[model samples]
Target chain A: MKTPVYISHPGLVTPLGLGVQQNFTEITNGNIAIQKHSRTDIAKEPFYAAMVSEAAINEAFKSHGAISEYTKLEKMMLLSALETLDNSEVKISDKTLLIVATTKGNIDVLDKDSAFNSERAYLPNLAKTLGDFLGVTATPVVISNACVSGILAVAVAKRLISSGGYDNALILSGDLVSRFTLSGFQSFQAISDLPCKPYSKYRNGITLGEAASSVFVSTIKPTQFAVQVLGDGSCNDANHISGPSRTGEGLFKSVQDAMKEAKIDAHEVDFISAHGTATIYNDEMEAIAFNRAALHGSLLHSLKGIFGHTLGASGLLETVIALEMMKQELILPSTGFDTLGVSKPLAIVETIKHQPINILLKTASGFGGCNTAVVFKKVS
Target chain B: MRNGALFAEIDAANFEGFLKQLYVMLDCKYPKFFKMDTLSKLAFMGAELLLSEISENSSEHKRTALVFSNRSSSLETDRKHQEAISSHGEQYPSPAVFVYTLPNIGVGEVAIRHKLQTENAFFVFETFEPEFLQKYTVSLLNENKCDQVLCGWVEVDGNERHGFFYVVGRNGKWKHSAATIKNFFEHD
Candidate 1:
């Protein structure tokens, strides 16, 4: 029999709050983080985004290490990883692996007026910095795949641990809403002016957000609420570098492959944590993919309405939230969703409901035509 | 180069010129080759050279995964995008350039060219970690994720261009191990 991997000890730092419980409580109480930000350093015009408070991050990080030595993204990532390490019994050792996931790390350093050296923008350098801070001896791995970097990191951790390469793996994923990303999204005209309404007919574009989340994957169960990493599949559409496939070919295959590996059918999944970025094409494509996978009966919700699109952190952040929902036996609603917009219909959750969630599926699709689907099962 | 032997050396001035000359020598007809950035061009060239002999059957393509790593993660295109949005330039960032800002786009470009819809991952390391790559690719194959994997280190930063790509399969003449991979990367 193959070794089973379990995931637990979620650590989150987002616009909503610091800890996983805090963010979960805030989302349960119907709170959102996206707001209008007129910061000239990030954008030329006011844009809506879910931004973590720098003041909060600085205050929280003050107790851990010297504040000036780390970049904002590093501070957020370090704090999240520290929480995971402290809350769990796992210890850092030569066999322990650290995976850092991000599309752009310390990207602010590239700005003309930045304080730090531009070399910090390199992904490997950022991973090394995090590894040193976390007391990880093994050479850290960095995944720079567009937005799917987060959960894909988790999948990588599971594979490494299962392959007997590591005792346990700590995966930290973070990305900032900086001038680089904001300007690029603006160039594509993909940024929304209002809080995003995913899967709604009136939805216009994505609302960018910033966050850092950490998850520990190991062969041993870390907590009672720990979930088993049943299976995962990542596929590239092989169509466009920037745009998602209209036929949802990659996502459809990903979900199908994941479920096949997990030895489960479409009817077995209780709920889905979808990558609903509130963009027209993305939502439509997801709807088609879900229908194609025969997942129309599963309750689906996109946390983007609450956290906005957290880029690299979205996949893992939403997966962490899904785990919490399974533990709490509650289904969170899709915050900004209204009428069904996509041509194919999806069972979008509209309100919080107490239900037994045994099997959960998390899916993410991002730039470079990449799509990832991971299946998780609640431990009883 | 095939089997560590020089197939043909192009006489050109710079990296771009060398790529153009190589493209002509290879007789590549794909128009998208001209639009890709330097990183994607290098990766594409390497993938084309390696996969040219493989059959064009879609099922075979479906069982092939693309595993790539690099030191500089799309720094060339990132510099261009940053310049456009900086105060020094017109502040009009082109979507085309911004799309290639991520290192995986090069992998995506190769996937699109070869129509690979299997597992894909792009890692960034300080230097090439052959042991890690060997283990990870083996695990993917052992786990039945894919039958064959195209794995390598493709690093392109301005004038510095280097790519080492090879195909790993269930049956091979040479063992797919860290020492062998390191030898191939170093000797080439």
Candidate 2:
């Protein structure tokens, strides 16, 4: 028999707070942090984003001990890794395997006017820097598959841990609102004016956000409260990269496959963390998919209203927040959820409620019809 | 905790020619009636040979996985997505071209054609993940997500394209040939 991979530790850095503990404290109380950018080159259209202030980030690094000058992207990764190790009470040693996921891993370095002209690209160098900081022996596996990069990073770590190739694995996924992504979204007109109202009637578009979350996976069982990643399946939509399938068949299949793998009944899921980008077709397609999955009555929420869309980091960060919320036995309120807009709205979680949380279906969809849903259950 | 697993090999030189040989092998295995297109040629060819025996089956093929990794952004479609929005006067951007912008959509193309919806992932890195294949396969199998997970390299270096994959399952028909399993890329 093969070993089962479990999430031994988790850490997150978002608009809410820094480190795993602070993020959890905010999530449980339903503290939403969609703040205005004050000023930017981007239009006032959807100026709201879940921005991790520079001060908080600096403080996080100070808490970690020392810092370096690789790049902000590398710093985000290192900070999250430190928080994860601290929360898990694990040491950063030469034996650990660190996996880094980002679509634009050190792509920000390209904006430095050096990568374009110079042969010194930062991605290859950034991974080495992150690995060196953690004192990891194995070279970090850097994955950058569009939006699914971070989610796939977790999936890859899960696979590695299950194979017992490594005793402990860390997954760090982050993406900021760079001119590349920010402009791309603007080019596609996928941006919204207000903080995205995921399932609200007359919802317009998505607000880009930045986030980084890290989690540790291991074969050792947890002695205390932990969320068991029962099952998850990632697949390409094959429909269209930009336009989701009208049928939501691929998304539907992902949820179905995950439940099947986890040996879970669809109805057993208590809450759904949707990839609610607030786009017209995306939300519509999601509603169709959830209804088809018979998840009509389950509590559903898209924290994008509070955190905005963090792209690659959104899924991992959201999953971490969801698991943290489980610890407090409290569910977060879905922001901008005034009226139910979805054709088949699965009970949109409107207000924060304290309850006996058990199972959660966390899902995300991105470019390439890449949709993934993982069933996490509170280990009994 | 790793389970019994192995690898398969594909020569990554002159991808088009390699794909042609792959097509013949796949056509022989499945005998499909549809004519193939250049767009689906490379991906379909790789997916076909990777799961030669299982590709012919139409039912419950989910247990047979399809995983690929590559760094070359889909330049073919990437260029097309760029060209279409610029050229088309009234038509919305060609969704078809915009679709393949991601390297992993190749996995979707194969999954839909083979109807193998079991377990799949598109991994991207600067270079080969070296040992992630066997490691990931064991995890998926142990988790009972797939009967046998397939994984390999799928990239377009230049005018050339390359990809390789093999199914991994525990069938005791053959002996535990550690030598063969270890030397797959060399001889298989």
Top candidate on DockQ is 1
For candidate 1, lDDT tens digit of each residue in A1-380?
Answer: 88999998889999988998999999888899899998988876788999999899999999889999999999999989988887586677788888999988888888988989989988899999999887888998999889999989888888888988788888999999988999999889998879999999999999999999998899887656769999999999998998899999899988998899899999999999999999999999999999999999999999999998988889999998998898889999999999988999899999999997999999999998999999999876
Q: Which 10 successive residues of model 2 chain B have the least lDDT summed?
A: B1-10
Candidate 2 regions off by >4 Å? Answer: A1-4, A24-33, A36-48, A62-68, A90-95, A112-125, B1-45, B48-55, B58-63, B71-101, B157-161, B167-188
Locate the minimum summed-lDDT window of 10 residues in model 1 chain A.
A85-94
lDDT of the candidates, in the order given: 0.90, 0.67
Candidate 2 chain A: 10-residue stretch with minimal lDDT: A113-122
Model 1: per-residue Cα lDDT over B112-179, one tens digit each: 99888879999999999998899889889878889899996889876678989999998887999999
- What C-alpha root-mean-square deviation, in Å, does candidate 2 show against the real structure? 5.8
Tens-digit lDDT track of model 2 for A60-178: 67755554454555667778877777747445455467777766554433343323321223344556777777777776766655666766666667666666677777788887765
| CAPRI verdict (incorrect, acceptable, medium, high) for model 1 | high
* lDDT for position A146 in model 1: 91
In model 1, which residue pairs have backbone atoms overlapping below 3 Å?
Answer: none
